[model samples]
Target chain A: MEKSDEALMLQLQTGDLLSFDTLVKRWEKPLLNYCYRMVNDVALAEDLRQEVFLRIYRSTKTYRPTAQFSTWMYRIATNLCLDILAKQRRRKETPIDAYLESESDGFDERLIDPSGAPDAVVLKKEIKDRVRSALARLPENQRVVVTLRHYNDMKFHEIAEILECPISTVKSRMAAGLERLSKMLSEQE
Target chain B: MDCRFFREQIVSESYDQLDADAKKSLKAHLQTCRECEQFQVSLNETQQTLDQWEEVDSPIDIEALHDVIQPKPLSLPPQLPAWRWLAWGVAACLILTLSLSVLAWIGVDVKWADRGLTLRIGQESVPEITEQELVRLLQAERHATQVEIVKQLQGALDEFSKQLQVHLEERQKQADAQLVLIYQGLQSQRVQDLGFIRQELQHLAGATEAEFLETQRAFEFILASHVSEIQKNMK
Candidate 1:
């Protein structure tokens, strides 16, 4: 049995370090993963994650849990990401791995199983490459929406709450995102 | 009334955010229309590709988050000279005194709120270098801002690297290869540009004429490949 995020967050409000730790344990991976995708830079993503936690820590006393815990957390993360996006708007964008021919992000080729099984090795590498490329095609909003709905298993309404948009907008972003990917995949072959 | 309603419903069905009455009418029409039936397949395929991309698994790490929460020790070592400690104590007092004075000058009611959102004020109060940044931002057609949108792309790239691992895992969903490729390309550009920009922020901000020229050249590269370019050209 797990303590609900609401319960954990309430404990955090009292300056309970352990409770905050529990909340962190529950959210860290997903939060980190979300930040990573949202910012697309490892350092910045990590920085953003820390920033989010710092925010949560500060707001803990003020947190009212009016919405779902995940929703609130995401709201903070999204706002931070959006601000970063706004700032970045002033400069030129360079896609990661554009200059380097290496595989994207930080999973070097070693992620492939070295079992000496050629096909399996090739299969894993191919999967990695394809997944990387598929993610790249999505708009930031679409990418976040897809990740939230499909990966985190959030409902459209919940995603709406998280994104602070109308539920219809979340659905719209999701639909368009999916539509865009489906068209791209069709062309890839 | 007949075909147009059906067509609108067909597209709207993909979102399913439609109201129940609309859904019911749309479903009824979809059941009867051959053209709509075919259209549904395409829509479903598109929906499926997006869903699948989310399912694909990627390598991700979770514990790295622990390091983010622990507050660093801010205390000085015990062996510091008495004078140094006294100086530090005096400096801390003066800083606190000055900050409080400033807050009092601003008024406590507003000061507390401002404290929570000082960055917003900073942005508002600060001046942009000349009118160049604004001019560049305005001239962009939601497409041409890439040259001046360095920070945005850098943040995007940073996000890509952080999320790439998760992307591997979330990608377990079944998807069409071509759709994935284009999605990847767009995402890659976002990620790459972000990385490029992050590495060059201050450099771009105070860029020499030569550097600005270099940035403009990079924008040309993006202009060559942006999806919006295709959209604009087609129009």
Candidate 2:
């Protein structure tokens, strides 16, 4: 049987290096995707993801099993993202999509449309770009709420814990974010 | 029964956050309220639209993280492979035997019958000296000196590599520590920013509270006065 995260964590705390490897393998992709959407930059997201695991490895000795391992992991990852976003805010940098087009060719090529029709392929690409742009335009809190809700499939309470906010606030942000996204998608269509 | 309550439930129900009681109420309301029913349809459509945008699944480069979690180096010196050491010892023995044979061939009395080297020169013994024996001794001394020099160089190289690795690790740790410090500072600043916003909202709420009540009272008085004036004019 696969070990539980808590079990792996316990093993890691006892200095079993393999447990750390196992944990990293299990979480690296999901955490990378989470950070990508959070920061909207692939390279920055990977850096943040690495930082998340580095922090986890360092803290394993003091890690408490009181909460689910995912909760703690998300808290660390989201906080790192928020810090990056805050710094961007201070710098007054433009949104990622502004320059994303220059880099989009390399990335979007990976997401190939299975259908061979040129029209369908183009349509899919347009919708994908629109969704990303709309998501990028959302305020940070709402963007995070929707991303956690849809992409991570985290529970409202879990998201609340990660964001250090109330469940109602999470739901509120989700509602507003969804409504805006729906409107944006419709307009694009 | 009200559309407002049902509207709130629509979004929550879509998220699977609605309680059974609230869900039942919303379902009943949906059966009668065309507007809210349309809203439900739109919300579901929105969700479907979102579902179309699949998340990009990119692999993480884990080598960076792996470096941090990797175990420290063992302190013991690396030993040469047993086979290689055995080969070196055999070659050295062969060289020593070859030199002894050369001494015997050169007409000097040489004995190496397991008690180690012994030699005689010109039958006077000459303190047990032979020219080939002297040459053999010199060659053996040179080989041993070369081996010692190689070993010392190898040790120095190992030490240099270890120190380089340690310095690289120290630099990485320092960079990580600096990043963490910056992250903490940003987090605190975010908290302060939130607190400041909350305080401003509270202040706005206080300032608006009396104005809201006073406006309500004034509006009611105006309606009453207007109604009486209309009645008088009608009479």
Candidate 3:
């Protein structure tokens, strides 16, 4: 039987490095996706994911299984992302529209269909670009709630735990987010 | 019933989180309410639209990440502390003195005394030398040894100075990087704090405006009531 994450964590507390490796492997992709959605930059997401893992490794000695391992991991990731976003906001380095334009260009080049279906691929890319743009335009709080709920498929309570907010707040944010998303998506149409 | 409440219920319903009773109530309301029904449809459509944004596989290099996270052994040997090096130098001097003494004790005519070294190679060491000649010879040898020792010390000092300069430069670069990071962090924190304060001020302003309007309405009602009472007395 596979060891539970908590069991692996316990082993890690005992200095079993193999357990750490296992935890990393299990979590890296999901974390990568979460970070990618949060930052809206692939390179930045990768860097953040690596940072999250490094933090987890460094904090192994003090790690407690008081909560689910995933919750603690996500808390670390969410903080790192929020910190980066805050720094970016202060710098005002890349405006959202400019970032979207650059990203759309890359998407156009990278998402070409290998099956020789250019029209279908273009339509799909357009839809995806619209969705990504709308998601990016949301306020950070609403965006996080939406992303955690919709993309990560986390329960409202679980999201509440991760965000350190009340479940009602999470739901309200989700509702507000979806309402705005509905308007934005329709506007695009 | 306010449709606004039902809209929140719709959102919960869309996520399949509505309990049976709430779901039944929402269903009954949606049967008669076009706006709430349309909201539910729009939310569904939005979710469907988001589904088009597929998950891409992560391109992280696990091996590289593993290498980065793992504790690495020191590539270079650990540097010795200055005191250890000093102790080793003292031990080397003592060893050299002991060897010289052994040679002298074995009748090799090598004598090391009062920081001066003397050596005679063969057993035929019965040469008659004057005390002044001996003193002159010892002084010349001592002066040569002092010059050589001074040269070696100067070389070691030069090397040590260079290493210290390099180390200080590296430390300066690291400190500069840390300062930059600290400045950026502080600036970010300041921005966040200002934003929070601005939001609080706006909320306070909104509340104060509402309270002022309510007080004005109360005063107007009281004034109208007084005027009616005076009109009745005049009649």
Candidate 4:
């Protein structure tokens, strides 16, 4: 079994650069997926994921092992996404998807299941696209909660900690998000 | 559990989020209620669809990350030539001696006595070109220096007082602005709350009116039916 992420972070805290590499390798993809879903842009997601690791390394000296590694990491990533959204709001930029749609060079292919037969692959791709599109349509608050719950498989209490909201609020948001997602998917059908 | 309770628990139950007791109750209710069972099926389907949306294999550049985390090799300072080293040494010695000489000139006596080199203030009074002229010049310079110092202090005091006043005014303005903002926020919140309360009251009143009208219509219909029944019986 691999060393746990907290252990790796502890090693990093002790100035073990190799352990930092190990952490980046482990967290980069999930963080990338999270950023992509949050921002709905491939290039921006990749950039934000890179920044998340950089910030983690920068803060390793002050990092305490009080919280779980995943919680800390997710909180960092979540803050970065929120910061980017705030900047976008300030600049009054076009919607991320509007740009993404124009640059649509198979951005959704990141979720493709490669081992399936051609027809099965196509159908799977369609389902993934529909689900993702519906996810994209949710308000940012609902989107973040739903994605954390579903994509990251975080518990409601963990999400509450990350969001700094009450567990009831997280549950209500999740239910509301899921209900809206249900309606959106049904409409697509 | 009633259908409403089961409906509320459906999402949690489907995701195994409910406690064992709640789960048991919800499951028992599910067995009895067709609508809730259908809701559970749909919620599970929604969760499965969400699960199917997996992340793709997008490779991160580990090399780039290495560049960020890798420790940089330490570089040694370049070796100086002998003459350059000599120059630096001479410069450092000169600066030290210059500072020492200036200190000695400032009334500290430096001497080579019988025992060794000694440093002291030997004379209580120094002979100038003219003692009177020197005394007058010294007194004049001292008075000028004192006046300049007093002026500088007063200027600093005035500037500081102005700055303090400005700072206090700014702080007071900020506090007042914050108070106004808070008051406005509370006012708007009160308006929103009142609006919501009024809407709820209106909705309740409408419902009560509808119920009263419906009851009155039902009473009238009953009276008409009873009269017709009696008339037919008497006939």
Candidate 5:
């Protein structure tokens, strides 16, 4: 049976290096996806993912089993993502154009299935691009909530824990995020 | 009931987070209110659209992360020269002899025989050093020297490894930047190719339309001439 994340973490705390490796392998993709949606930049998202694991490894000695391992891990990732976003804000960097440019830069080709019909492929790519752009336009808090709840499939309460806010705040953010996304997607249509 | 509360409930219900009691309440509200029902439908549609943004595979692998995180093991330094060890041994012997000589001068009797050195101070005899004891002392000194050499080597190795890691990371960043530039160039070229194709298609379409019009005009004239010829024959 696969070890639970907390179990693995506990083992890691006891100096079992393999447990850390397993944890990294297990969480790498989810964390990468989360960071990618959070920042909307592939390379930056990758760097953030690496940093999250590095932080986790360094903090292994202090990691307690009191909370779910995923919660702690995501909290680290969320903070790192927020820090990067805050830095971008300080620099007055507008990422909307960058997001659009990346979409057109053949990066979306990874998301497209080549075996599909040409017309269907094109249509799918267009819709995906629109969704990504609409997502990027969301406010940061709402975006984080939506990405965590919707994309990561975390429970609303779990999201609250990760964000260190009340569950109501998380739910309201989710509602607002969905509302905005619906409006923006309609406008795009 | 205020629709705002039901709207939030609708969002929760869309995600299947609503309790059974809250779900029933939301359903009853949705049955009566068109706006809440429409809100749920829109939220669901938005979710379905968001699903198109599929998860991408992480470009980085675990090994790369491991390499960055795992501290490199300390390496043993190169072997010390035999001459250096000889010089150290000689210096140690000289210091020991000088200390014994000083002790002898301070009203102490020192005797050197085949067994080892013996000392007597005021008719009280000190323990003699046996061959085994002397050999053990020399071995201990050599071991300590070896440990110190190993420690110095480890420190140097650690420094080199750190510098190498920084250099590697810098190079990796440079390569990543170059790759991004190349990718952007390709994207722009693709866009330009698409624009050129679009312009060519428009030109071809215009020429096709002009030829079509010319053919239609000629056909009309030929039909008119045929009709006139027929009328004349009938007259």
Candidate 6:
């Protein structure tokens, strides 16, 4: 049975180590998907996924049940990934050591994104990657608002709270980011 | 609503967050306007296409994470009192400024060269000195005294920063008990009596040495004045 995010978090705060392990299992895939899309590096995304959980551990004392647990957890992850990206801007973005379709991914094309013999899905992912690459090139705030909204399916109010922006502002940024992405996608097409 | 108004509304509408009136108006507009309806379709398709971006899950090596965490009890630094942490941080920075000054006095050129490094210094060298020649002779006797006095000050400041880092680690270690005490004090303080918001600003200031020192003094001065004011108010 699926537990409510709040309940899982309550269990987590009480030092139920198994709750944390379960939370990690529950969230690891979605969080990785979100992070991997944002960062475009498998290992860094994995590393960041761990950092997100570790941060959850560190911030357990401060965690409140006022918001959904996924919101709280992803907010921390998004912010950390954004910070990593901002720092990385001074040098490089790709983990140069891990980009050659990592050998750890054995020779199964389905493994890359699990496209079940659908070329459209594969192409769509390529387009997604291109759009993401373009997004990383945009200003940080724009990238985050778009990621939180379009990718995470967060409502404008939730995104505003996460970003601490007015709803109008989040809308403006998402619109602007999507506009830019439309241009980039058109160019790629 | 004008087309522009409805157009702007469409983006949020696409998010499924629009109110009933606005949603009704937009739906009506889409029914009447071919352009908007086609635009809505394209937007919908784009979102569906974005589904491909979701990451395929990866297998985790729990043993690796357990390896990192199992070594000891959690190694997180104990949180400190704002005033004490600020004080030690400033004191540490001042001490750093003095140490970097010393390393400067030890010399920047030869010491750097001996460490198998290179620096682009005196870009437009004097008439007698080519940068290449100076770099080559940096280790020689002629430039042995090349350690400039001003540079010595910088080395001392860097040394201070290094030492301060050590002190901060020790301070964090030593504060374990004191933090427990202060945590108790805060816990005991009536919530209405005091309110605090902790700010962790990693981007304290500019990266340059001179800028860093100025930033340190400014923060220290700000906190010191604020603390004194708080004490006065309490009295």
Best by TM-score: 5
Q: How are the candidates ranked when ordered by lDDT, highest leading?
A: 5, 3, 2, 4, 6, 1
**Residue B23 of model 5: what lDDT?**
89
**Which pairs, if any, clash in model 4?**
A110-B56
Of 2 and 6, the candidate ahead on TM-score is: 2
TM-score of each candidate structure, all chains considered together:
0.51, 0.59, 0.62, 0.58, 0.63, 0.53
* Alpha-carbon lDDT of model 2: 0.84
- Which of the two candidates, 3 or 5, achieves a greater lDDT against the reference? 5
What's model 5's lDDT at A143?
Answer: 94
Best model per DockQ: 5
Report how far off residue B56 is in candidate 1 (Å): 10
Displacement of the residue A129 alpha carbon in candidate 6, Å? 4.1
Candidate order by decreasing TM-score = 5, 3, 2, 4, 6, 1
Off by over 4 Å in 2: B1-5, B71-235
**Local accuracy of candidate 2 as per-residue lDDT tens digits, B112-154:** 7788977776566347779999999999999999999999999
Clash counts for the predictions, in order: 58, 0, 0, 1, 0, 32
Residue lDDT tens for model 1, A43-159: 576678778888988788788978898888888888898788667655655654451234343543435556659986765555444544665557778888877765566778888
Model 5 chain A poorest 10 in a row by lDDT: A99-108
Cα lDDT tens digits, model 2, A25-87, are 898878988888878777788889888998999899899999889999999998999999999
Write the number of the candidate with greater DockQ, choosing between 1 and 3.
3
The parts of candidate 5 lying over 4 Å away from their true place are: B73-77, B80-235
lDDT tens digits, residue span B138-190, model 1: 66655566654887889888999889967775665445666788899999999
Return model 2's CA RMSD, one decimal: 41.7
Residue A170: error of model 4 in Å? 1.2
Better of 2 and 5 by TM-score: 5
Per-residue alpha-carbon lDDT of model 5 for B125-183, expressed as tens digits?
67999999999999999999999999999999999999999999999999999999999
Residue A88 of model 4 has an lDDT of 92
- Candidate 3 lDDT, tens digit per residue, A1-189? 989998998998898988988888788878988887788887788899999999988888898889988888888999999899899999997976677788776544655667858888889888988988998898889988888888887778888999999988888888889999999999998
Scored against the native two-chain complex, candidate 2 gets a DockQ of: 0.30
Error of 5 at A159 (Å): 1.1
* Candidate 2: residue pairs that collide: none
